[model samples]
Target: MKSSARSRLADRNGPLIPNIDIARPRPYLPRLLKHLFHPVFAFALICAVGCNPNGESASGKRKKERQKTAVVEQRDISFSISVAGEIGPAEQVSVRPEVNGRISELPVDIGDKVKSGDLLFALDDKDLQIELETRRTEIASANLEIRKAKQELDVADQEVELDLRRDSITRAKLEQQKAKDDHARNKILFDDELISKEVMQSVESAYELAKNAVLQAERNLQLSQERFRKAKERARTNYELATNAVLKAQRNLELTQDRLSETRIVAPFDCTVLTRSISAVGQAVSGSGGFNSGTEVMTIANLNEMIIDAHVNQADITRLSADMEVDVAVEAVIGLTVKGRVERIAPKATVRSGIKGFGARILLISVDARIQPGMTAKISIPVVSAENALSVPLAAVFTEQEGRYVYVVVDGVYEQRAVEVGVSDYRFAEILSGLNAGETVSLEMPGEDAEVKEMPAEKDKGKRG
Candidate 1:
């Protein structure tokens, strides 16, 4: 009778309670009776043996039915490449002096905003000014020397005229003609027996002496002209040397003035001073000399426009192009997202830290004050995208020998169907054809024996649930 009753209870409750020998007599029969009759224990036993088939609880069946799957839906899907980069000003400059000098008057400091041509600093110009004065004095002295040489040249020219007049060549010629006439008259008389031979000889001697005087006069004139020519050449040379000296002095003066102007440095453009290398007003700085370029005086930048430098994986670099729009997020400023455009992409690939990638520059469409140089930025560049496309979880799609496919549930059975897939991100894949919205697809591969059915036509796609 006890066995029959225990079997009956097991049959009614579905075997959740263990077989206990409750029909046997025990010293703690009263305690056992009280515990077995408690409401909590009875309710727990009923809950354990829930009203479901095969002695399994309702929750067990629900859990078993919860296999990973996704429902196809019409949604926006895109493929993007995300990368980490750094933000910087589009135009930055390291300011330096053009000439070596001491900072005499520094007007701009770090963080100062300046307009184009505003004075940034000044160097001491006292020495240059003094040198410039000396150059002017030299030029004046050269002018005086030029004037003195001109006077000497005029005196030498006047001496040439004076010496020519003093030679008396005309007077010597007249005296020679008179002596020849007298000698001719005396010779005719001596030959005709009208004068003595001694007188004729004396007249001949006088004529010869007159001819010698004419020759002497011509020699004197030639010597004086040559001396005058030499003197004029010397004077003209002296004048040329003085003029050259003045030119040299003028050139030196111009150089000194140029250096003086350089003492005042001005801003090249409208910008903000980002750094100041000099601490005080008189720090010395080097200029471009030999192999040394110069001592950097300060740094400035135009903060209105900014750029992000990012390295993209070589596999994804081929998809990037100039002027392509992208999205940017600043790490320093939380929740700050802005639009950017691709400015350039490196032609060659570079390896950094054992990873090969291409360097790309992205220009910010708009810059925020909070975005600063050296700030970390995240860039999302879209390679491909689709709007309101029929899509499913990426895991739901699979590729096999027959091309890409998916296991879609139809009539409570997984049916393999070939699919035309488009762009896919990390989460969803765009279905170009072969699948319909409202259909369910298995996330994991179904059994090999699952029938591969012919997919619907393009017009009939997204019609079946």
Candidate 2:
């Protein structure tokens, strides 16, 4: 009965019992708890000691902290700005033909040197020559006509003078004959009855016939004089017309001769032949007014007076002014740099949609023998610069409500430094004051947690006092 009772009790408690091995030691909970609490307790004690208000005077302690926080360092810096540009000549010119013609004679080729007045090419002048000859012939004919007209005018003038003289003499003779016939008729009328009526009638008839003859002769002479005057006036008009025709013909002939001379192209100035499109002989060239008008027979340029034509951005043009110094480098002649200046800026900007920029041109200050026309070049314009100035990298400078400031490393602590700035470039800025050369400045400062505390009111009062 005792054993059964013991068995029943064991079964009832068996499900509730936890299994354990004698060889394995139980987990040390007390030890783990002590280990965890040890660090926490120590941290609390540290905070308590640090926060003690009476241990150290706040002002003295703050002063010590300030000393500890100040930072100091040293660095090297430079200030400069960079802009792109290109090299160009001081003077350059483009050469084109003045008259249109095919090239009959081309005396030079590319790179060939030529002097002023040198013949470059020739055009076929056959038509011009013929036209000039025709004009000259016309002038000769007009001149002969003028001479003939002058001779006719002189003869007409003499005939007019002779006719006037004849009119005067004949008029006087008619007047004398009329008077005599009147007198005879009056004297014979009274005696006619005695002398017989038939005889008197015959005398009167004779007188009348004679008087009519004299009058007729005078009228004929007057008509001849008027005819001579008209002939003289006609001759004078013809002579004048012939003279004007001769002058016009001569002028036309001269112009045609000039056109003929222009057919032989000549260099306007010393230049180099860049191209020759014609041969020496058998090449037919048309005149200026022909179908081959404006055709290029050859090309010439003044290579010695070369200029670089470069385009700069419009945004940068405002910073550029005339006479500003520049440096140029030609790709064709590498390792060589030429000096130049800003000669001019375009008033109106040229918008290039592809690049979304405008362009400007700069003139080279000087020339070099190696430089040639059409050579590619690069230019560097210093928009701003400083020498031996107190400067720092742009990153080291920052703005504040007070003004521009920099993080100066004062005795190993970052101290906010107020700085007056001057000229600055993209990479650097000139620090006018509050910083010295060789002094270290921070590019960045620690975050808010690392911020230095402000002094208390009492400390500030003492400092003011």
Candidate 3:
């Protein structure tokens, strides 16, 4: 029993020896844990202190220091106004027909340069010539009729004069016979005293018959004189009527000739032909409606004086004036800029698509060979400009209830600045006052102060260590 009791104690002691070896290594583990945990605990304490609301961290302090050293820049600014315009000739003359007629011969073609009084086209003159010849024949017939009437009047006057002379001689002979018979009758009366009284009565009857014949001859002479006067008057009236008829016919012939001359169209001034409407030589054209109502057989325009007709919006019209300088660019001839001036402005606004715009005419100060009529152009009008002026980005200027203002960084703090503005374009604004060159300005608004802090490089390295 003693031996068994000793063996049992040895077995319990042997297991206890292996457990002690493991326990010895466990003490070293506790020591390592203590060494690691002390530094972690200290780091936690430091983080808690720095993150507290009462105290600022190292990163926060560095951000404030950098803000104080920020800088800004000043730039020279320019302002310009741009508009789309069209290039055209300064003068445009529309060639229209005065009297309508068929285009018989078109002498000029498109792009032909012509001078004043140059023949442009001709109309058919066959009908006009025929009418003129007919009028001349009528005039000749009227003249022949007038000559016949005058000759008849002259014959009638000569006949009346001869009849007057014969009637006068007959009257004188009848008077002498009447005197002799009376005297003879008186002598017979004395002798008849012894004879019959019937013989004396016969002599007295012969004397009375002679007296009546003389009175009739005198009346015939007076009638001849009156007939001669009437014939002469009629002749004079016929001659006047015939002369007027001849004159009228002559006038009609002259008028037809003039119209025939007008058939040849001519240019009124120096110009270039823009178009030609007729080419076929045998094309039939109506005499009355061939080229009226602006149906141009050809078009000519003076290109030396070229002008641009631009439509300016009503909002910008108020700022325009005569003689203002402008730069024009034509789309047809690219990379060319022509100088021009505001020549005229329309008195009223024109509404197109419910937008109101006014017509403005721009005259080219100098002629350009590249500029042509109907070409589109882009116009730049300089409203105002300043050289070497204080300026900033347009985005930097912000409006408030007072006026324009900008945020300027001063001494690590953003301060609001009131600035006077002059002019602005798409990119920049001219700062008239309240800002200087080389000053720092913030492009973005600052958030909370804590949000702007940056992590320190030393802290990140220490954490890695």
lDDT of each: 0.78, 0.60, 0.65
Model 3 per-residue lDDT tens digits across residues 360-388: 99988877776777888877766555566
Alpha-carbon TM-score of each model against the true structure = 0.73, 0.64, 0.62
Q: Mark the regions of model 3 whose C-alpha exceeds 4 Å error after superposition.
A: 1-104, 137-233, 288-295, 320-327, 339-344, 378-390, 407-416, 426-428, 437-465
Superposed Cα deviation of residue 377, candidate 1 (Å): 3.3
lDDT per residue (tens digit) for residues 383-438 in model 1: 56778888887667665544566778876577777677665665677676778779
Candidates arranged by TM-score, highest first: 1, 2, 3
Top candidate, metric TM-score: 1
Q: Is candidate 2 or candidate 3 better by lDDT?
A: 3
Q: Specify the poorest-scoring 10-residue window by lDDT in model 3.
A: 16-25
User: Model 2 over residues 22-141: C-alpha lDDT tens digits?
Assistant: 111233445545754688866765566679876664434554554211122222332222344444334333333444445566667777888899887676677777888899899989
Local error of candidate 2 at 120, Å?
1.3
